[model samples]
Target: MIDTHTHLYSEQFNEDLAEVVERAKSQGVEKFFLPAIDSETHEKMLQLEAAYPNEMFAMMGLHPCSVQPDTWEQELALVKSYLDKRSFCAIGEIGIDLYWDKTTLDIQVQAFEQQIDWAIERDIPIVIHTRESFPETFEVLKRKKHPKLRGILHCFSGTLEDAQTAIDLGFLLGIGGVVTFKNGKIDRFLNEIPLENIVLETDSPYLAPVPHRGKRNESAYTSLVLGKLVDIYQKDFREIEEITTQNALRVFGMK
Candidate 1:
């Protein structure tokens, strides 16, 4: 399985990073896509990817929450510099987030649109982060629709209508541990969308599944997400694994 969006480099795992990766590998999670948060984490992310070259992949972007008025342009420029100098799996973890602070709404929109243009120009997929800004996000994507603008909506928690909108925009719904929550509404929407338009992710060390909820999340919990998918799709484990893995490979351009 592939963890499409994870922050293994986060200080949350500093105490047991090796064991976390080993546990994840033992559970068949062979690949991890690490999303960049800001310049402060760029080097650490690169270090993690270097340490596990075959298993860890990195993406470059300036997360909406990380964008301050003074730092937004510099961060975006740093993203552009990273993209030009190296190859990344996606232009990721970038989108509008009004949940934390509504004051940065305008700046977030500008940054999100700029990153979308960057991805389109480079012919690469993106990993989007949307929280309480689905309407705004959809508005931006709709206005700047491009055939090459394809990606996943990380940790999707939107409505069925929103899911369909993402699908219509050539985007996949990135399902994670949230589906296993007793109150997660994504399960209701999953039944409406085909498994083909879905991809598996852990978003670790963050949203651990069921039994591990509230604890530190890791890629090892990908199986829990997969197990939930099986229950939702009424398909076998192996089949769900194969199809989601294929979907991830297709989006990240991995073999």
Candidate 2:
């Protein structure tokens, strides 16, 4: 299985990073896709990817919540510099987040559009992070619609209409531990959207699945998310695993 989004570089795992990865591997997780938060976390992310080159892949971008008015442009420049220097799986973890602070919405939109342009130019996917701003996110997507504008909506917890819109926009819904939550609602209409438009992710170091919810999430808990999908789709475990793994590989443009 593949954990499409996990912050294994997070300081929360500083002491037991190795054990976490091992435990995840033991659960049959073969690869982890690490999303960048900002300049501050980039090095740690890179270091983690370097430590496990074959298992961990890194993406480059500026996260919405990190878009401070003063440093956003400089941060974006730094992201561009990194992109110019090396290849990344995607340009991602980028989008608007009104949940934290609505004051920066304007700059957030600018940063989001800029990164979307970068992803299009690079002909790569862009893993989006939208929080309490799906309308705003979709607006940007609609305006910037391109043949190459494709990605996964990370931690998708939106409505059926939103899911259909994302699918219509050439994006996939990233299913994470939220589906296991009693009030996560997405599970109710998930079957309406084909499994082909879905991908599995842990969003780890956050949103751990049931029995482990409200605790530090890990890639191993991805299995729990998959188990939930099995119930939602009524498909066999191996089938859901194979399909979602393939979906993740497709998003990253991996073989």
Candidate 3:
């Protein structure tokens, strides 16, 4: 299985990073896509990818929450520099986050639009991070729509209507541990949308699945998510595994 979104470089795993990777690998999680947060994390992410070249892929972007007034442009330039040096799986973990601080809303929007343009110009996929800004995100994506534009709405927690809107815009819904939450509505939406447009993720070192909820998340728990999908679709595990894996491969251009 592939963990389409994860932060394996996060300091949260500093104490047991090796064990975490081993545990995840033992569970059949063979690939990990690491999303960049800011310049501070760039080298660490690169090192992690280098250490596990065959297993981890890195993405470049300036996270919305990481957008500071003084450093936004410089950080974006750094993203461009990284892109020029090496190809990334996606231009990602970038979007608006009004939940944390509404003050950075304007800057976040500008940064997100600029990154979207960058992705378009390069003909690469994106990994969007939208939180409490789905309408605003939709507005920006609507204005920037292109035939070649495609990506995933990472960690989607929006309504069914919103999911449909993203789908119409050529984006897939990135399903993760949130679906396993007792009250999470993701299962409801999954039942409505086609599984072909869904991809699996752990968003690890963050949203751990049930039985591990509120603890440090890791790719090893991705099976919990697969189990939830099975329950929601009432389908076989092999089918859920095959379809989601294929969806991830197609989005990330993996073989």
Candidate No. with top lDDT: 2
**TM-score ranking of the models:** 2, 1, 3
| lDDT values, one for every candidate | 0.92, 0.95, 0.92
Return the clash pairs for model 3, or none. none
Clashes of each: 0, 0, 0
lDDT for each residue of candidate 3 in 99-206, tens digit (9 for 90 to 100):
999998999999999999989888889999999999999999999999878999999888999999999999999989999997877777678888998988999988
Question: Between 1 and 2, whose lDDT is larger?
Answer: 2
TM-score of each: 0.98, 0.99, 0.98
Give residue 166's lDDT in candidate 1 (0 to 100).
Answer: 96
What TM-score should be assigned to candidate 1?
0.98
Worst 10 residues of 3 by lDDT: 182-191
Residue-level error in angstroms, candidate 3, position 80: 1.1
